[model samples]
Target chain A: MTNQEDQFYITKILEGDSSYYTHLVNRYKNLVYSIVLRMLKNEDDAHEVAQDVFVKVYTSLASFKGDAKFSTWIYKIAYHKCLDALKKKKRNFDTVSIDATYEIGIDQVENGLGQLETAERKEIINKAILSLKEDYAAILTLYYFEELSLKEITKVVGGTLDNVKIKLYRGRKMLFGILKKQLDPETLAIYERGTK
Target chain B: MKEEQNKEMEALSKKLFKEVELQSPDSNFEFKVMEQISSLPIPGSMAKYKAPFSKWVIPITIITLIGSILLILLFGTGNQYDIMSKLPSFNFEAISSPLQRIPKTVIFAMLALAVLLFAQIPILKVTFKNRWH
Candidate 1:
């Protein structure tokens, strides 16, 4: 729904037609879920945290000020919830070493993925995205998947536009490195079985 | 040659990233979140007027108030009495007896309210600090 429609629903809900909030929950749940999922990387944890994000959004809806798009605001909430959960678990994104990477020759790196079915390739990319540092994964998700403007992402991620740009640039490179590693021949042969 | 390889990699990454759509959760995820939201007692701020006055209202109110004060200070000498006389007055004599009749229960309630307000002092301090800073 449009931001105008979001405002309408918000006003209606505030005016005591609380059911209109269902429209908002429906509109943003996936956007919330995907951001949380990419950061947390566990389906159950992601689902729980996604629910928390919506609850936080609903509870804080009155403070939303309309200074940003409703989507950006909700994304900011989801990002924070993920961060809080990670902090609580004392779990940092484990950055695998470049040596840990599966070093396929350059041709094999691109060509093996090229030969895969669309579904297999998508799985490869999804796995690669999840393999990056949590911050990088989140940046990539916001930029590439959610299609937020860099400024919007900076608001969500809390940094300067230059910081977001640098992260986005580095995030793409890291994602590529992960994808290159995962597309090695043995891994491709395994995925060719239509497994994992 | 390096530039050509970089261009090719950029193209491939773009194609792959674009293919990654925002993934949907389980079919019932929206219902699940709404269920939780529904369970939480709607906060007082969620009430209609607790919905903020239009953001413009604050600046406008301040400006109008300041303008009125300035108008009175500079040019309202003759009209000051008129504006003062125009203010609606309460018939407090009727209210005074009933107010005196308020029971010990209400006195206790007032004490409780005072305690609550005292409790809120730190919160108010933080709120003002954040607002001004």
Candidate 2:
């Protein structure tokens, strides 16, 4: 729904027609769930945290001053709630060394991805995304999937614009690195066939 | 060449992410959230403004105790001690005379301490209430 429509429902709910909240919840559930799922990486934890995000949004709805888009506001809430859940579980996302030797050209990787069925290609990319550090995975999802601007993402993720840019840069590199490893043999086979 | 590759990767990422479907929560997710929201106090329905026990009770008790002490010191006649003398109790003169000789500064300090102690009750009550919420 449009932001105007969101404000309408928000007004209704604030006026005690709280059942209007169901519309807001339905509107943003998938978006909020997707971000929470990407960050938490556990269905059960994601489900619980997503519910907490909506409930918090409902309780704090009056404080939403319309200074930012409703989607960005909810995303900020979801992101922080995921961080809290991670801290509670003592789950850390420390940086790890990725194998750097598996680099392949983007064109070759693209050709390999094209050759796979849609579901298979999607699975490979999703798995690679899930394998990265949580911050990188979340940044990638927000940047690419949600199409939030770097400025908007900085607001949601709470970092300087340069910091977000760095994360986005590193996140994209790590994603490509992982994708290259998974698409290596397939791209090599395609290369061989092309050479023949 | 590096910049060109970066552009290609960006385009590729955009294309791939578009195909990534969002995962949905359980069908009852909205119902569950609404259930919890229903349990919450409605906005602007201010709870009844019942005064906290410490807010009124502590001050009243402190005032009564101080008032009773003042009344005995200011209004008690010499005959008030006649009842004690009849009981053949330990000499009240020793205690009463010594109490009167005690320094005014000391009396003021003790009264100040009592006031401070009573003051903290409401402060602590407020602090704990804030922490709980």
Global lDDT of each candidate: 0.71, 0.77
Q: Write the per-residue lDDT of candidate 2 for residues A37-64, one digit (tens) a residue.
A: 8788889999999999999998788789
TM-score, cand. 2 vs. native = 0.71
Fraction of native contacts, model 1: 0.55
Once fitted onto the true fold, the runs of candidate 2 whose alpha carbons sit more than 4 angstroms away are A93-104, A184-187, B43-133
Model 1 TM: 0.66
Q: Can you list each candidate's DockQ?
A: 0.24, 0.30
Chain B TM-scores, listed for every candidate in order, come to 0.29, 0.36
Top candidate by TM-score: 2
State the lDDT of candidate 1 residue by residue for B1-133, as single tens digits. Answer: 5456556665766677887677789988877876676655443332443323343345545565565556555544452233223433855555455554654344444655565555455445534433342
Instruction: Report how far off residue A85 is in candidate 1 (Å).
Output: 0.5
lDDT of 2 by residue, B17-132 (tens): 88778779999999999888776644432222224444666676677567656744664543233333444566776566555566544554577567666656654554444334
